[model samples]
Target: MRDPVLKHRARGMRMVPTDAERHLWQYLRNGQLGGWRFRRQHPIPPYILDFVCLEVCLAVEVDGGQHADSGYDEARTAFLKSRGWRVLRFWNNDVLRNPEGVAASVLEALGGVRRADTCPHPDPPPLGGGGN
Candidate 1:
């Protein structure tokens, strides 16, 4: 149920990313951050996430001054949350000037768990018929 138009737009966005996006991509690409794969300019239908880790259902957004107090962004965040995605937002300046801090926050939201070692479900049901 993917939207083709949004997918095309996302592809175009990836071709010419903003300065902050470009810089942040260096840290997020190729499982560089926490060994978790992140897709840049990823489409989630009706919106394009700046970056998303599908494994953890986490979305990261970097915003410029134009987004200050934006009603649209608020709505978008609400929608994404309703769909079970954890959203983290950072100012463009912060990403450019303090990437380490931003990355730390993202990692913290990710529960500081490395992707390969982390289990999707921490507790599993026992396999046998109990006390038969």
Candidate 2:
């Protein structure tokens, strides 16, 4: 269970996402990409993640130009990483202009299963079917 205060704040954050967040959410929302459900502006105590795919233990942050060399973001990344969550950061323009590339990178990070219907190849026909 999450704290009520944090949950409230996360809800507000969801309602007022940045344009870059909105753009990226288009691909991340509703399990659209890789069938991985992502929560936006999700709070994980002490910090709010821009987008999180809990199934893969991955957190993604979308940053504006002001975030260049931001120590705060660095600390947040460290904290999340310490908790066994991999962090991925993308610039605002990056998500806005190149959403496909962003989604592809995310899929790669999640081990690249494009959709539920598509899957990695299974082992081939047991080589020779045990026949002489």
Candidate 3:
């Protein structure tokens, strides 16, 4: 179960996204990036992801100078990875100055592959294969 406080915090963050976050969101929202849907300010326990495609288990984070060389980020990434998520981090300047490039990198990581471990549903049985 998710903490209610964290869920509320994530909702509040969505209401006041930073410039870089807003910029990246344009590229990520509505399945604009290679048909992958991304949710901003999504709560995933212990942390709120800046953006996440839950279907593919991909997390995209945009950071400012304050996050440079931060140990907290390293541990956070490890935790997400342990939960079967693949995290991609970008600097605010990079996203603001070259939004296209940042988006391209994210698309490349998506690569049209959905990991079974991360997919929400198991593969369904083939039609007409299973006996009644």
Model 2 vs. true fold: TM: 0.81
Q: Write the number of the candidate with greater lDDT, choosing between 2 and 3.
A: 3
Quickly count the clashes in candidate 2.
Answer: 0
Off by over 4 Å in 1: 112-132
Quick one: how many clashes does candidate 3 have?
Answer: 0
Q: Could you give candidate 1's per-residue lDDT for residues 1-132 as a string of tens digits? A: 447799899999999999999988888899887787889998887899999888877899999999999999999999888776778999999999999888888878877544552223212335674454
Candidate closer to the true structure by lDDT (higher is better), 1 or 2: 1
lDDT (CA) per prediction: 0.83, 0.82, 0.88
Predicted structure with the largest lDDT when compared to the true one: 3
lDDT digits (tens) for residues 10-108 of candidate 2: 899999999999999999999998778998987787788899887767889999999999999989889777777779999999999999999989988
Question: Which residue pairs in candidate 3 have backbone atoms (N, alpha carbon, C) closer than 3 angstroms, thus clashing?
Answer: none
Local accuracy of candidate 3 as per-residue lDDT tens digits, 25-127: 9999999998888999988877999999888888999999999899999999998888678899999999999999999999999896764555442124456
For each candidate, what TM-score against the reference? 0.83, 0.81, 0.86
- Whole-model lDDT, model 1: 0.83
- Span of ten consecutive residues with least summed lDDT in model 2: 115-124
The CA lDDT at 24 in model 2 is 93
